[model samples]
Target chain A: MRDRLSFYILRESPIHRMNPLTKLTLVFSLILLAFLGPVEWLAILLFTTVILPLSFLAHVGREFLSATARLLLPVIGFLFVMQSIFLPGGGTALVQVWVLDITLENVNIAFVNATRILTMISSFLLLLLTTHPSALMSDLARRGVPGPISYTVTSTLQILPQMQVKAATIMDAQRARGLETQGNLMKRIRALLPLVAPLVFGSLVDVEERAIAIEARAFNSPRQKTSLVEIDDRPIDRRIRWGLILVVIFLLGSRLWLK
Target chain B: MAQVTINNLTYTYPLTEEPALREISIEIQAGEFLAVIGANGAGKTTLCYTLSGFIPHFFRGELQGKILIDGLDTANSKLYEIVEKVGLAFQNPFNQISGSKFTVYEEIAFGLENLGLPRDEIRSRVEWILALTGIEDLAERSPYALSGGQQQKVALASILVMKPGVLVLDEPTSQLDPIGTREVFQVIRSLAHSGQTIILAEHKMEWIAEFADRVLVLDKGEIVRLGTPQQVLSDINLLSSGIGLSRYTRVAHRVNQQKLWPKGQRYPISLQEATEAFGRLLSQEGGSKK
Candidate 1:
């Protein structure tokens, strides 16, 4: 609610100044290239040379690195563990522990898969870090995405923080009334019902009112809508979008040739 | 001619046995500030929704009668069509937020944007309304970051920017603190003075006594009393009906019970009137003693 619920960083940079649709295209293109490029190390190469450098250009390098290490590394680590150990039917076993076997070929495939996933998520994360949700929704709506679809996405972004705040308040109030949330796992699980019931029921009541509110504002009116905050889409932004598409196609073509 | 006419209006919510409004009839003319006062479960909020065309359209309940606002029947028209003529801002300020925009300026422009107005006109209208509601400095701030009063003002400005003929406010300050209530009331007072047609339901009696042109008292979903503020607020039966009276009116009522007030003089409903009435009585008694 402060600026947005997403990872958007407010900064003045070329990436921040680009159109939201262009940044969106760039995100999908990066993801496509990471998954379909010919080289086995293509995911790692894109992460280092493309995504990391672009985060700096977007003036969010520190946030990008810290968030990646904090939020994504654990999942990737778990994936690598499972894939290297339980992965069957390939290559020589480098290590054998108890009943599990870890193989060099399996480890290599796991590393590549993990890096590809990292590249995919980071590309979308970069887009989120640079673009506001409203700007993205507005651009999509203008491009003939139905108004309700865009509205649902943007409203969900806004309401999520509010619901969390409400949940916290409910938890605090219940705790003050001698409802224990810190104890055995069973006790904590039991505490969740008291906390969640009010949050959910209270929010349900608000839904009717919010619907009436939006209707009052002519949200369902059948007409071409306008936007207040003007999003800029210069000639360069369009050219960049086309360039990203071509790169995605090239990556796909190379992947086919290799196969 | 932003007149609101409700005739024989009896409405029940969906799946409810008892009607929320019972055979209600009221006509509000253009540029009139009508204040509706009642206790909890007294049908005041229901009346506000009915006037704003949400009863038959949005709620889709069984509405026995018809409501006409600005010559358009509420039952026959779509809510989007009725909304252009009537705007409603209800009790909870947070719920009234459209939840679709980020900044206060865009929030105000949301309605105009949906209505397909030109960009320049929408900008000017939003700017003027921001200043009008005294929230020009908050234009760039996130709507969710605002205080309750500030958010309510933003809600009000969001509606007023649409230029609806009739504005219906249901306890817009109910969720605010004293200072916040005053801030919102100040904006509403200005809107009242500017000849806007307003229907307000409130529990605060002092502001109603001071600013409202006409007052309607509802009890058990029926119109019990309807008159000017002085006539309705100063009624002796108002205290017994559970709808609170202003402090000035209560004091005057006490004085009348003591047989000190003049036999035929009307009881005062506001502080200024109460002071003048007592002052006149005191001077007259002093002159007779001399």
Candidate 2:
């Protein structure tokens, strides 16, 4: 269920116990380095080496690799077919459907681009596999984010499951009205209009009623709203927090000094 | 003492052919509980909206005449001012709760904080309302995690914390079970006892009969009758044909028509009264059940 997405353990290890703010900062910094820093193949290889163990420690290394294969296979196949036929850098024409020439340059460019996308996606997915939404929000709040803003983000996260329930309720209501969602594709697609119309209308009605209820409850009336579930920063959290900060500093420092 | 006053009021829907309310007039005194009863098309909800200043203001209807709250004209009052005077607990509790807090304590504080009370004051008021509604044990628990009855109590506590002059409920306990109904009735009773004018629009007439001092029967957009509980329930002809009557009244009527016992007052509402009235017969006849 989408509700349980927050609880998935990509890997159960000591690293997962690190303070979420620390993990978040580290992941974001790594993403920045990959995207904005030098395009050295060694750096990319090093990033992948660190991420593989993290994936394995999170117990999702197999899933992580298979997912990469699933996404990259088609992209690699398309690149091969196109580059071998028309691209100027495929070394020699390996295949020609008509007048197209496949070359080594196009093959190399596609390979680099596909690898870049795959690595970025895998790293992000691994981050989600190990982090909880509530923990993430608590980290966001502690870093000077306003309570209401954080609450809005957290509640929005919490509401995804509720939206699923609302959608189910709408589907059931439509089914009761004789609109079959389980029918043939065209039939179901046509049936969707009636389903969508009421859901949107009912959601709008709920939004108004909810707004009135919110007004009555005086949600925006208070200047400061306190969070109930406070996250504890253990010693494990502290060490990881410090370690992540040091790595960010060293990487950026080396980038300038080595230059 | 009239917490709410209506004078020669008429409201028609924006595009409808007929008026939703026609020259309706009534005065609800402070601390008095009034129940509005009607069929599906009786305009019970419309009348509440009209008095609360939602009609013509929120709903954009044709309004003629005046509706007042403690002598303040509601026709042109801002919604916030109206909300200060009248707190409406809408029909559905789930849709009525707006905050995303887990605890009932936070929910109760919602309105007081809106009133711009100091943090200490908000804390005290939240604590007071929590105990007042007997939901202190539920303070830490998530409201979305509660049952219908508990959720309704949270909703009531949330509104009651504001201490509005009048509380308007639109079938608040309709979706609740019998036990939940009893819990809601207790809250309403406490609110009324504290001198808050409570307006209950409900279909459950038996509890309403026991709780409210007065009744207003609306039929097809017109105020058919309005009076004290006894005055409304004692009318045999009016009670039978009226759109909404407590189930007990119809049963009492059935028992009254049996003629097995002599009718003196001609109406019985409570189970104790029905039993006590027949106790004399049991004693006189020396009747003993096997």
In order, the Cα lDDT scores of the candidates are 0.90, 0.71
lDDT of 1 by residue, A1-259 (tens): 5554778888999999999999888888877778777786988999999999999999999999888887789999999999999877867889888988798999999999999999988888888988988889988888889888998998888888998888999999999999999999999999999998898899999999999899999999998988776889999999999988888888789778877
RMSD of each: 1.8, 6.2
Q: How good is the docking of model 2, as DockQ?
A: 0.24
CAPRI tier for the interface of model 1: high
Off by over 4 Å in 1: A1-4, A257-259, B283-290
lDDT of 2 by residue, B177-284 (tens): 999989988988888788788898888867776888898888778888788777775556654434556555566677667765455755655555556655665675
- Per-candidate iRMSD: 1.0, 4.2
lDDT of 2 by residue, A147-224 (tens): 567667656654556666778888898789887788588988888788778778877887777876765554544334
TM-score of chain A of each: 0.94, 0.71
